[model samples]
Target: MTSPYAQQGFRVGFDWGPAGAAAVPGSIVAVVDVLSFTTAVTVAVDLGIDVYPYRWRDETAVAYAEQLDAVLAVGRSQEGITLSPASIRQAQGVRRLVLPSPNGSTISQQLSDSGSTVLAVSLRNTSAAADWVAARLTADPSLTVVAIAAGERWTDGSLRPAVEDLWGAGAFVAGLADRGVGPLSPEARAAAAAYREVAGELPEVLHECAGGRELAAYGFAGDVVVAAEVDISGLVPVLQGSRLSESSKPSRFCPVT
Candidate 1:
């Protein structure tokens, strides 16, 4: 008999936050934060900058940046080194950046410490990230992956499922499917289905989603647009320690609903 725990239910699975990540057992983990963090990291890595995930923009982050000799991102709209994808893409003379976010960064930090292979994924690099992971799985056939969507929180502190992230992660799962990776778990199958449903309408869907409209109302709609772009980037960020760097065509990306 297959023990319930032994089944693990998901070899390629999708879940929301750190708790969700913990619930899904996998040798590799992918963290998705499409509206921001992961989007910003993808942009920064494409520009050849290393990124560090910090949970807060506080003194601890400042000190950590100093320790890593990295630039700390300010507000998403601030003048210099902010979390804006545009800023990170345009900034020069910086080799490293520490980006802080409540959702993505927290999950990245948690996964990094969990000792699993960690990859950061966003809409910008979905295909690349998934392909990277798939190649590894094909090579070994013993590794499992879990894509965790770093879902946003409500103002009153509740889990707010962001559609953009679902799309990002879904695209990842779909990419793995395209590579003929597995009999995907139910959660992974649903995520891939979600991606196929919205693949052609990604930009409009993101623009109209709650998070997209919220950012647009705050005058950050360009960020949403950037986050919606699929596979324009070739960068795949792999988390090693607390910092994220381009994984040299040997890394990964994935999931949520």
Candidate 2:
């Protein structure tokens, strides 16, 4: 059997605990902040900069950025900033903010300590990331690309899968499936597509979703819409540590959804 990262081209599966604990050291972790962090990372990539996930929102981030040749500081909150490219340009450390918030970066942080090359991907840049993977895994097509869906939070010895996040992942799987790329298992394809079929409103799609309901109650309709765009930019945000930026390939565009 192939090692997990061997399967992902960088081992690291997408669960919080032991199931994913195997994902450490030399793995390529794709942090999926479908709601916000991933989008923030995408915004940074659109500007043509690289970012790293922060170990701590408090000092480590600032300290790390301080060490970079060029650094930016970014933080995410449900209450601040517009995801629009224009607004992203105007935001503080839009290029390099120490992400410490409710969405994507938190997951990025989890894989930070791991030596894996962490990459932030979404529906918009799913193909870019996938193509990158395909190229690298040409020698090891069995590479495991774990799609971390930012799902529902709970305490029942089980965490729930967020509908919107999973839906996005399904679109990603479908896109890759269409191309017959990577270790995108049938289970992954089904997981992402199964949820894509059910629909009402964006919020309705994410209804019962641990995070989406919260996003709905807080009036993030615009965000939900942005998160669901099938293949908007073809940009994938690969994580260095505290800030995120484009992968090795910037102009390489592919369609996964």
> Cα RMSD for candidate 2?
6.6
User: How would you encode candidate 1's per-residue C-alpha lDDT over 158-216 as one tens digit per residue?
Assistant: 88988888888989999998988776888778878988998998789999989899999
Any runs in candidate 2 off by more than 4 Å, and if so which? 1-27, 59-89, 92-94, 152-160, 182-186, 195-210, 249-257
Q: Which candidate leads the pack in lDDT?
A: 1
Task: Give all candidates' CA lDDT scores.
Answer: 0.83, 0.54
Q: Which candidate is the best by TM-score?
A: 1
At residue 91, candidate 1 shows an lDDT of: 92
* Candidate 2, 88-137: lDDT as tens digits: 55566433444454345556766666666677776567777767765665
